[model samples]
Target: MLVTGGLGFVGSHVCVALAEAGYDIVALDNLANARLSVLARLREIAGRRISFVRADVRDGRALAQVFRRRPVAAVLHFAGLKAVHESVAQPLEYYDTNVGGTLTLLRAMRQHDVRRLVFSSSCTVYGAPESLPLTETHPLRPANPYGRTKMIAEGLIADCAAAWPELKYALLRYFNPVGAHPSGRIGEDPLGVPNNLFPYIAQVAVGRRAKLNVWGGDYDTQDGTGVRDYIHVMDLAAGHVAALARLESQPESFTVNLGTGRGYSVLEVVKTFERVCGRPIPYEIRERRAGDLAQSWADATLAERLLGWRARYGLEDMCRDAWRWQSLNPDGYPERPVSAAETRRRRSRRRS
Candidate 1:
């Protein structure tokens, strides 16, 4: 198996699950929003070596060389810019990296004769969802550039599958992925300010930030805050493994939603985190975010039926496990220290 963005938050967890399932992995990542130290942490957690390549998914030549060096049974596509607000600011980068990158990867897979792919998609495809408990057959209408890229990528996969009848693909549309590896070794460590709720809250609890700003509290939900389906990171990882198994066994393309089928409001999450961490999470209600939906959960019946997978962790579990990782690594991961020679060279330049 090959995992793009394997060094990232969800991808790393998926790699751990794949390792536990007895699969040798070749992970390729650009490390744009990740660190090399995670490779060591993943090795520690997997108890096995994972061959890694430091390259971007958009580099087709690099991907082809990777395929030539070793035969890959499947490709787990997880690389792309994921921040919604950031996407709103820079749509072109998102399209090039997310959509164009997938195109490059698809071409490489074709050249290498690899037929299996497990795509990491989002529930954002069902933007401004009309109803609660979103189903797999829900309409396709994304609200942001980040989500639009995913939707376009999904379409490309579908088109490729249509042309190549023998190809098998699994489009796993999941909800909000929270929490971390129970070991607390590898977790969500976004660069700069986080664009998600849990990370912001976790950082505040860890004293890295002063307070968390609740996105919207005027919504028509309990506590008047937005509601979302927050699934544990491990559960999301396990869902990917299950989807891969199904793709390997079945020779057809399919789509499924990975979520707990339950919704939690912003205030509920804060209260839960407060109880779990034994600290007050200072938050203030603010205007709604631009691309946010008031309430969006999942009808994960399709996932359960297709892959025999359903989220096993709930709200409290997510809060507790997330706090564990945040508390352990208040400052996400340490950057490599500068070498003495390099430091001296910089100092010499400054003096000159």
Candidate 2:
């Protein structure tokens, strides 16, 4: 198995799942938004070294080299720019990385005669929901560049599958993925400010941030704040394993939503984290983020039926596991090594 962006939050968790499933894994990452330190943690938890290739998926040569070096049964593509607001500001970069990287990876798979792919897709492709509890049949109406890129990549995969009848693929559309691995050894560690609510709350609980920003307190939800279906990262990782298993067994291609069929308001999540950590999470209600939905969950029945997969962890578990990770890793991942001169400069400033 070859996993692109294998060092990232979701990718790293899925790597653990893949390893436990007895797959010989080669993790390909550019460290664009991930840490090389994660490889050590993965090894610690997985009980073996996972092969790694530090190369961008968008680089055709690097991808081709990976395929040529060894035999890959399938490819799990997770490399891409994921921030919605960042995508809005730099649509070209998103297109270049997300769409272009998928295209490059597919080409490499084709060249290598690798026929299976499990793609990392997002529910943002559904846009503002016309209905609650979105199903696989929900219309593709992406509201932002990040979502559009994913939608486009999904199309590309479908089109490739149509052209190559031998190809089998799984497009996993995820809602908000939260929490950490149960061990808390490996978990979501965003580089800067977190783009998702769960990590932001955890950061505040850990004193990494001053307070939580609860966007939109005037919505039509239970708490008048945004509500989303938050699934544990472990469950989401298991979904990937299930999808890969199905693709290996079946010839047909499919798409499914990986989420709990429920929603939690922002205030609810903050309170839950506070209770778990035994710390008060200070928060402020701000203007609703543009393109923010009042509420959206998932109808994950298809996943349960098709892949025999259902989310096991609920909101409390999500918060508990996330707090474990956050409390343990108060500074998130460790920083990259700095120059000796830079270290001395820091010490000199302290002395002065």
Candidate 3:
């Protein structure tokens, strides 16, 4: 299998799942927002070396090279710019990487006769939701450029599937993915500021960051804060495996919401973090973030009915594993280690 952006936060966890499930992983990542040190950790957790390719999904030639080297049965395309705030500032880059990258990858797959894909989509496609427990049939009205890009990519995949009857695609619209591998060796190590709440709170607990910024504590919820369906990253990873198995069995395209069918408020998460880490998470309520939804969880009925998959981890598991990862790598991952081949090549160039 070929997994684009497989070294990223959720992608890395999926790599561990795929590897442990006895699948030979051919992972492609540009390290644009990830770490190569993660590769070592992935190996540690996976108990085997994963073939790595340092390349972007937008480059067709680079993608084709990866395909030439391996007979990929399917692809899990997680390669995209995903920050809602960043997407607002850089819509072009978001569209280019997220939409254009999927186009380039699909074309390459068609050429290679690899027609199966598991796309990473977002619940932001629901756009503040007309009702609670967003379902797959819910109208798609993306609020941010990042969400817009995912909507566009899903459309493109749907169109491609319509044109080719043999194409099998699974569009997984995920809610907030939290937690880390149980091993704690591989987890979310975001570059710069984190857009998600899990990493932000973990950083605060680890003392790397000063305090957590609670975005808008005036919403109507259990604690006057937003509530979301935060699925554990490992459960989310297993959902991908389930989707892959389904696609391999049937020659059809489908979409599902991968979530826990439960909601947790921001203050609830902070309290959970405090309980798990045994530390006070200092926080100051700030203005609501733009494009922020007050409450949104998943129905997740279709995912369970079709894929036979449902999230197993709850808030406590999420908090405990996240704290483990944060304590282990308080400063995030170390600098990328140099491979022996890369070191030798540099030395030879210097000698000449």
Taking all chains together, each candidate's TM-score versus the true structure is 0.95, 0.95, 0.96
Question: Candidate 3, residues 1-352: lDDT per residue as tens digits?
Answer: 9999988999999999999888999889888888788888898889987999888899999989988987899999999889999999999999999999999999999988898999999998889889878999899999989999999999999999888868899999999999999888988887788888999999999998899998999998888899999999999999999999999887678999999998999999999999999999999999998668899999999999999999999999999999999999898888754454675798799999
Residue pairs of candidate 2 with colliding backbone atoms = none
What is the C-alpha local distance difference test score of each model? Answer: 0.91, 0.91, 0.92
User: Which of candidates 1 and 3 is the stronger one according to TM-score?
Assistant: 3
Mind giving the per-residue lDDT tens digits that candidate 1 earns over 1-352? 9999999989999999999999999999887888878999999999999999878899999999999999899999999889888899999999999999899999999989999999999999889888778998889899999889999999999999899877799999989999999999888887778889999999999999998888888889988998999999999999988988888787778999999999999999999999999999998888887777889999999999989998899899999999999999999987643344665797799999
Question: For candidate 2, what is the lDDT?
Answer: 0.91
- What TM-score does model 3 achieve against the real structure? 0.96
C-alpha lDDT of residue 276 in model 3? 93
Candidate 1 has an lDDT of 0.91
Worst 10 residues of 3 by lDDT: 335-344
**Number of the top-ranking candidate, with TM-score as the measure:** 3
Worst 10 residues of 2 by lDDT: 335-344
lDDT for residue 270 in candidate 2, whole number 0-100: 84
lDDT of 2 by residue, 206-255 (tens): 88899888889999988799889999999999999999999988878999
